[model samples]
Structures are given as C-alpha cells and as structure tokens.
Target: MGEISIKTEIPGPIARALLERKEKNVPAGPFNTVKTFAAKGEGALLTDVDGNTFIDFAGAIGTLNAGHCPPNVVKALQAQIHAYLHPCFHVMMYEPYIELAETLNRLVPGSHAKKTFFLSSGAEAVENAVKIARKFTGRKGIISFERGFHGRTYMAMSLTSKVRPYKYGFGPFAPETYKWPYPDYYRSGGLDPAELDEALLSSFETFFLNEVSPDDVAAVIMEPVQGEGGFIIPSKGFVQGVKKLCEQHGILFIADEIQTGFGRTGKMFAVEHFEVVPDIMTMSKSIAAGLPLSAVTGRAEIMDSAGIGEIGGTYGGSPLGCVAAIEVIQMIQNDGLLEQALKIGEAFQACFDVLSSRFGQIGQIRSLGAMCAIEFVQDKTGKRPNQPIVQEILRNAHQRGLVIMSAGLYGNVVRLLVPLVISDSQLDEGLGVLEDVIIQCCQNQQ
Candidate 1:
C-alpha cells in the first residue's frame, strides 16, 4: 500500500453532502482546486471527509513549504492562543511582530538597513509595495511583465497582464500602469536565447519613448520565476538587465516573491539565484505555513516614505501569524528544507526526463528547485497548447489520490509545488501517480 488510499470516489457521500451545503452558502467568486473538504492534513498528505487520503503537490498554491501542520508551527500557534488571540497590532504592538520583522530584515538578500511591515495577503503586500515605491520615487507609472500575475486587488489587477478570470469585467483599472514583454524562451520563435534577451531588454528604451517615460515610472515589479505565469524562469542576464534599467532610470525594482520566496526556488528567495538585490519585495504564501500573513520588506528609507496612517490594516500581522512565521523561518533553517528542495527538484527531473522520451505531448520540463512544471502541447512538432489533455490528466490524477494544479496563460502547464518537508516515500508515491496518469491519458489520446 502506498501513501494514497482511496476507498471512496472523490467528493464521496460525506463530501457531496458538504458540497451541497457549500453551494448554497458560498459565493461562486472563490475557487477550489479539489471538490472535497479536508478532514485532516499533515506533512504532504491530506485526508478528505470521505476517508480518502491524497498526496499533496499543490501545497495550498505554493503556501506550505514547511508542510501542513508542522509540529513547531502548531506548538507555536497553541502557545500564542493561550496567551492572546488578537491584541490588534494598532491597539498594542506585540513582540512576535517585531521579531518576525527583524528576522526577515536579516534573512532577505540585502545587508543594508531594512524595515518590514505586514499585511493579510499577497495581493495586499503588492498593493502596499506599489504605494511605497511611488511615494519614494515620486512617480506614478508602474511597469509589470506580460503574463505576470501579481494579485487581484485593484492596483495589483491593473498591473497584472492576464485578462480572463482575473480581469474580465473589472474595468476602469488604476491609471499609469503599463505592461512590458517577458521572455518566454519556449515560444521564442527561432531567435537565439541571447538575441531574445537583448531584443526584449532593448525594447524598454523604445517603450519609454513610445509609451511612458522611464522618468515617470515608479517601479518595475517582477517575479524571479513567474508562478502563475507557468513557472517561467528568466535568465540571469535578463534579470540583471532589468535591474540595470531600473537603476539607470531611478525606478525601484520590486521583487514579487509571494510564490518564490521562503526556499521554494532552491535558494531562500528566487532573486538570490540571479545575484540581484531588489529595492523592495512582496512576500506571503508560505511565509507563515498556512497563516494568512504577508509582508513588504525594503530599504528603511523607501519603506518609511509612506507617512504614518498611510499604510496597514486591522488584522494585519495578527499575533498567530507572526508567531507561526517566526517558527517557519526557524524550521526552514534547522530542518535542512533548502537542501531537500534541491533533492525534490532532482527527483522530479529524473522522473519527467524518462517520461518525456516516452510521451510526445511533453513539450518543456522546467524547474527552479521544487517549483517544477511540465508544459503540455498537442504534439511535439506542433507545440500547440493542449488544454484537453491537461484536463484529462488532472482528472485522472485526482481520482488516483494526488492533488495538483494547472498554470500558464493558456492553462496547459502542470505545476508541482509539493511540500519541502514531504517524506521520500510520499514524494515517490505522488510522482508515480502523476506519471501513471500522464502515460494513460497520452496513450488514450493516441
């Protein structure tokens, strides 16, 4: 018997009953990856209400690098609950909040004096980072990349490049926001990789001439490895080139590490892989295990540009979130999770490399640490997005007791954000399930 144990259909009797209740009470705006309700979760395994156990690869959309219900995090949360729930940071500051800020300031790439503030979600962090950048630079125009997803809030949505579910009917977006091209090497036509980078980097100068003046731009926010944009990894030269442009034009470079931070990308942060330090950073997702906490860490002067009462929220940096985050950072350091992340990536590549040779639909196999993905296409020669095959594979994987998710602008990429603390056996079992499903689905298509 492997880690998965499916005794009932997905959304079995118990889940179906709950799903009926959820449909009546819950709004349709919110999305759910799995159709079942979680009964218990530990490490990389989650049990639904119907007694079916699944190996988790989605990791709450890249929010569980420390895994679900880590012992240290649970203990810390329990201790915090005993003392107090929410004293409310504005009413009376807490020690855990200050401790987390100090720790992030020290851990983030820069050695310069830094400050950190908290928010409730990754979107909130992006919004605040933009606010601070504009205040500090005294510019209104913000630049983001094509296919990049920052968040769903008004400003974050305005900066985002996707249009379907995220920005369909929401019109009259914030002004002074612009989009720039990001290199998608897989679809770079016939251009040399170096030529592609140079062409895109050079286009910025032209953009400033035709679109918005570089002097009027407040910042260029980027994801070192785009998460929602299909785990796209930009080359080191491209990243450095963007940073150079930001420096030359007096535009702050904000690194959106919401999905790539906290050891998800082999390094502590994906920006570290490129050897570039960001002027400001937005982080959330895995910062506090599963707690709803986000942060903006940056140079002290830049972060201080926003006057008092200009930023913050009522439930921002709740005591529980702060304590959980402090413990999560400690766990990542002490538990050898960073090295484990590299090992996970190696395991995934090993499996996918073999599968790629057997399946023609596998177009690209890419990863930066365990933030891995496999792009599916109609065929090897065509290289056209195959959303139908992806849907089939996802359905089969779910039935076989594996939880995963799809990404990319065309929704044809299968992404893996497995827990860094997942056991070797669980990791193998989960991968095996996905491989079996992919093979079965591809064979059927043939």
Candidate 2:
C-alpha cells in the first residue's frame, strides 16, 4: 500500500486547528463523523491535512480502483488537457469521447450491440438511464431493492433505500419508484436459498399482479454485488431467477455497477461473475480513476430509443475524462490487475478468517475479489447489527492511522477497498492494524 509515516496524531494539531476553519467555510452537514482532513494521496497512502500519513482503505469511496493518480491516468489527463478543453461533443465532435464509448460498448457484457453515453456523475448516469427506459418502454414504475443505494439526487434518492441520511425529510421522493427485497440470504431470517427462492420470486409475482402492475414497470435495477448494501453477493440462483422474471415481464434489467465496475470485483464487471446479463448497465466511480465520470451502456435499441438532444449534459463526455478512462482500461488489460485482485482477495479473506475465529462478533465476512466486508453482530445467535461497536473500532483504527468506510443497510459492516495497487507488505500492515482494533475495541465492547 504505502510506506508508513507517523509524524503526528491524525487530524493532529495542524488539522484540528484548521478543521474549525473548514467547517465554518463549508457546511458542517456535508461532512461525516470521524472526518480527517487530507492534504494529498499517492497510491494507497494519504498524507493528512495534519501531515500524518495513513494507509488508505476507502479508495476515495471506490473511485480509485486504479489507485490515486495512477501514472497512466495522469499522463492521459495531461495530454488531453493540452488538446481541447471543452468543445462540448454536441457542439463539435471529439475523437476521445467516441473512442471511450466504443470501448465501453464493446467491453461490457451482453452479446447484443451496445452503445454508451458519458455523464459527470453516477447519479446523472442513473437518472439518464431511467429516462431512457421510461421513454422507450412507456412504463412509469421502476423496481429496486431494499438497502440499495442509487444516488443522492431527487430520482436517485427516491430509488435509494436508506432514509435517515439519504431520504429522511427529503421526500416525498420521485413517484412510481418501487422497491423489492434483496435476497440477502445471510440475514434472511433462516430463509435458505430454497426459501429465498420462494420469497423473492413470490414478492415479484405479488408486485406485478398488484402494486404497479408489471405492465407499468420500466426497469428492474440491481447491483450484482450490492456495494452499499453490505457487499452482499446474492445467492447463486437469486440473480438468475430475478433476471428471468424481468424477462418474463418484459422489463428492462439494469445493473448498477457504479461501485462494482472497473475491476473492483475479481472480474472486469461484477455481472460477469453471475450468469444473468443485464439489458442496461450504469458505471462510474473507478472507471476513470478519480475523475468525475459515469456511463450508461446498453443494448443499441434501448439506448438509441432516446433520440438525439433528448438526453445529454454539458460535460457528459469530456475529452479529459474519456482520455483517463481509455488509459485505465488499457492498464487493467496490460497489468492483469484482475489476477492481482484474486491474490488480494485470498489474502483479505485469510485475514477475516482469523478474525472470525477469534471473535464471534464477526457474523459474516464475504467478498468478491477486492471488495470485502465484515459484518459486526452483537451475538452469534441473533446476528444483530452491532453498529456502536463497529463505530468504536473505526474510530480506534483512524486514531491508529487507518482510513476505512462502512456499508450495509444497518451500517454495521466495515467494508474495505484496498486499492488494487496496494503492496503485499502494505496489505499485511493494514490487516494487522484492523485485527488489533477489532480485538481491542470491537470484541471488548461485546
């Protein structure tokens, strides 16, 4: 990951003294608890605003799959910056934008002819995809899963499942958006795959029959590997079953790979791990390293249905962003990061296995390649979320110079996205830190 350097307390005197200045300048509500001001990041290490170095595990909220400022991305960004700043593809054609689209259209799963459109953010990409689905299908209802996170915009928030921070008091949200249950079999109330099979399929049956009848449904969107939904990998049959149902109902299946794409999971796309192929897919986050870019790639007919000028943004396909994406794809291909992710996955799982043995508090530790998560439970029997304990561990880890993040509908899952560029020594060091905190803080509280 990075060379260890501890010169001061994290958020030390420098950052602590300046945090007040920052809070006053920016709204306090925008920041999360346990905030640490960052000065700069290279690879997997972040030099904090206080001049303290931390082994970064957040990976810029899954937008740094290629690590911070990867040389390839940097070179491409620099080269693009010299050519043209902004002619706006709609105004004037640009080669990079079209090239990136062609690459994505070809790279994504699905044997059908696919097209791609660039956007500035995942939320925008999602919104645009929904617009296209509705425009093409003439359907008003959309189906998502509980605990799913789409985005923060109006439509995005409405599609998202959380309420406390994302949707509370933000409603009434967009109408015609419906939510179904995800087959989170781990916490499925003893509902085995067979039972989940009956439950989920029945839920869909009920929805199509009554609530927002199937005919009115435009799309059924999901994260093949639920990102914010606790890194929950659906049971083997769940995704396939769901996709079959969507096909049965003539619904457009959309996979939201915003957090799972760009090789965050073992494969280039999480959907590749599953057999079901989504008709449309939304990608962002790691696709262009840290750049603000997102894409909607789908079957030619569905995507092209929304006529020209029907959907587009000023910075939809910025040449600079496209340049970065092209290089990222190339690096992933040349460097074989996919194989590296497998090694990282094995190491990470080994770390969790040790933790699981030491403490029953670790109710679940599931991962897909590099995207790993550990669910903290109060008791082995109940599998109840122990958020308070998890928070304590996180705080302790931060004090010890490890930056991490949380996930799950219950917010009790400590998820890790150690940049694929992280070194073996760095991974061991970070794992050691987490192990120490997990034992000293999380288990002790129990």
Tell me the tens digit of each residue's lDDT in model 1 across 369-388: 99999999988887899988
- Model 2: how far residue 197 lies from native, Å: 2.4
| Model 2 misplaced stretches (Cα beyond 4 Å) | none
Cα lDDT of model 2 by residue, 25-58, tens digit:
8885675535667788888888877677888888
What clash pairs does model 2 have? 1-423
Candidate 2, position 175, lDDT: 95
Q: Which number leads on TM-score?
A: 1
Error of 2 at 51 (Å): 2.3
How many residue pairs collide in each prediction? Answer: 0, 1
In model 1, which runs have C-alpha deviations exceeding 4 angstroms? none
- Tell me each candidate's RMSD, in Å, in order: 0.7, 1.5
